[model samples]
Target: MRAVVIESPKQLHVTTLPDPTPGPGDVVVRVAGVGLCGTDVHMLAGEFGPTVYPVVPGHEFSGEIVAVGSEVQGYAEGDRVAADPAVYCGSCHFCAIGRGNLCEKWGTIGITMDGACAEYVKVPAANLYRLPQGVDLGHAPLIEPLSTIVHGLDVVAPSVGDHFLIYGAGTMGLLYLQTARRNGAASVSVVDLNADRLAVAEQLGADHVATSADELDRVTTGWEVVVDCTGAVPAIEDAFTRVRRGGTFQQFGCAPDQEQARFSPFRIYNDEIRIVGSMAILHSYGRALDLLAKGWIDSDTMITHRFGLDEYQKALDTFSQGTGRKIQIVPSLAPGA
Candidate 1:
């Protein structure tokens, strides 16, 4: 098997490696398509603190099962599936309280273990969610990221008819826009530095799009739900001020661990504003898959670039340049290969 290995910060190598074998409770998936998220970028740059080096860095992925563990049931070879990368210590205090996302020993597939930027990768059978009848593996990688966004919404728990103001029209931001509208936001507005992204947001059902929140009309007091998906310090700070009184503000993006943003504690208290942080996918992967199968999301338009596994570096480069929506790695399918 061949895979991409991050030797260290700024060091990457793609070469042949031994095929993975399923343990007693694991299954080995034949890699189909893998999506790269901002977390992968941070891992590659050594910015993600918990990432263990010499690890394969890909978490948002979709594939088919080729081998199942002896204890595995319900899933079999040839089953198209998307694996949830989140793995938590089941005995932690947070896990005991039904908050596995906050487990003390929280770890993810690509970040903490070898992942699917290869021809084959091992996954826990329990984490596998077989795709519904109509969903294809190509677009199914969106499930992982969408699930996280779903959890973000769960954190906000916004009521129907509430206005939503989202910062960042990147892949995650656009997904937030789609889901927010579906969740009954009266209107969804998007802000991004890129004009192209803002345009796509509008085409994807955003009521308004702009390079800055100040450019948006109406809702002058603020929005009922304000989400920051860019994770930039400035954007996070700006999003804080855009939340309407008694509204919720969700920090959904991954910012540098050392970075900090300013916000008004007085305003939060006086206006009854709620500030929450949504981590990665919780129990939302299955829901995300079901939503996609139900045609709730436009997956086709969400994924904009695909490359072969050998071109992992190229995928990273394109991602860094911020040229595409959801850039992915298809182990066997490179358009111009």
Candidate 2:
């Protein structure tokens, strides 16, 4: 087997390794494609706290089951699936309360364990969700990130006619826009630093797009729901101010640990604003898969680039440069072939 290993922060290698064998409760998936996301970038930089060294960094993936564990049931070889990467310590306080995303010993595949950035990777059978018939395997990786959107919206719990203001026009932001529209948002507006991304947002159903919130038509009271998907302190801070009185604001982005965003505490108290933070996927995996199957996401437009396992570094470079959306690694392909 060939895999890309992040030996440590700032160090990586593509090398041969023994093929993974499934445990009694796990299955080995023959890699199809893995989506490259911001989390993977943070893992490579050692910024993601749960990341373990020498790990294979890829979590958003879809593949065909090649080997099933003896104890696994209701699934078999040749099934196409996507596994939820989140691994939780089931006995933790948070897990006991059914909030495993906040588990004390929370970990994720690709960050803490070996992942699918290779020809084969082992996954817990319990985490796997089979792709619907006729779905493109290459597009299935979007389901993982889409699940995060599902979780975020669950936290927002917006009214059917509420207006939405989202920061960032990248993959996450755009997905949020589409889903918000489908979820009955009165209107979805987006802001981004990139004009190209803003354009994509408009094409994907955003009612308004701007480089800054000041440029958009101001709702008399403010947007009913404000979401920050950039994870940048500036965006987060600005998003807070856009929330209408008594409205909700969601921090859906993954911000750096050392950064802080400023907000008016008095305003929150006086306006009765609701502030919520959405972490990774909770119990939304199946919902996300179902949403994708129902055609809620434009997977064709979301995925923009693909690379082989050997081109992992180049894929990282492209992702960092914001050259494309939803870049993926098809482990079975040869480099530059």
Candidate 3:
């Protein structure tokens, strides 16, 4: 088996490794496609902590089940599936309350555990969801991130005919735009410092796009809802001020652990603004898969590059350049291709 490992910050190496086998109640999947996400960049930069060195780094993925443990039921060999990388302790207080994403002892594949960046990866049977018929394996990797956006929308409850202003035009931001539009936002606008990303956002159905933070004033301040996907301090701070007095503001991006944004206490007290922070997907992976399987999301358009497992370093370099919206690693490529 071939796998990509990050020994340390700024270091990605592709090396031959032993293939994985399923444990009791687990399944082994032959890697089909693995999506590179922003979190992977953060992990590579040593920003996100608790990532084990020399670990395989991928979570958003799709694959075919090659082996299933005897204890695993309702699944078998040759089944096409996508995985929910978030592993939660069912006994935690959050999990007891049906908020597994917020579980105190939450662990995730590709971060806290070895992930699907290799020829074969082992996952708990409970985490595997059967892919819908007719859904290509190439696009199955998108279900995880798309589910995050769907979870955020579920929390914010953006309604029909509402005007939405989304900060950042990156992959998550663009996904938010499409989700908001699908939820019936009369007009959805996206803001990003990168004009290229804003163009991509417009192509994805954002009614308006802004490349400048100051340009937000041109749009109505009375936006019905504002979502911040940038996670930058300045952008988060601006979101607090740009949302309408009574509008909802949702924070869907992850900021640095040490970074903080200040807001006026008086304004928050007087404006009646509702601010919500949405974390990772909570029981939304199924819905994300359903949407993808049903053709609600154009997953093919989101994928910009695909590389063989042996080309993992090149994939990392391409991801670091920020030129592609989404990149996937295909571990089952034919020899010499």
TM-score of each: 0.97, 0.97, 0.93
Where model 1 places Cα greater than 4 Å from the true spot, the runs are none
State the weakest 10-residue window (summed lDDT) of model 2. 212-221
Query: On residues 141-238, what C-alpha lDDT tens digit does candidate 1 reach at each position?
Result: 99999999899988888898999999998899999999888998899999999999989999999999888888888548889899999889999998
The TM-score that candidate 3 achieves is: 0.93
Residue 12 Cα positional deviation in candidate 3, in Å, after optimal superposition? 3.2
- lDDT (Cα atoms) of all candidates against the true structure: 0.90, 0.91, 0.84
- For model 2, name the residue pairs that clash: none
Estimate, for each residue in 1-337, the C-alpha lDDT of model 2 and write its tens digit: 9999999988999999999998999999998999998888887887777888989889999999999999999899999999999999999899999999998998898888999899999999999998989678998999999999999999899899999999998899999999999999999999999999988998898999999888888745699999999888988988899899999999998886667889999999999999999999999999999999999999999999999999999999998887778899999887886
RMSD of each: 1.2, 1.1, 2.0
Q: What ranking of all candidate models by lDDT puts the best one first?
A: 2, 1, 3
Task: Tell me which of candidates 1 and 3 scores higher on TM-score.
Answer: 1
State in Å the error of residue 54, model 2.
2.0
Candidate that beats the other on TM-score, 2 or 3, i.e. the better one:
2
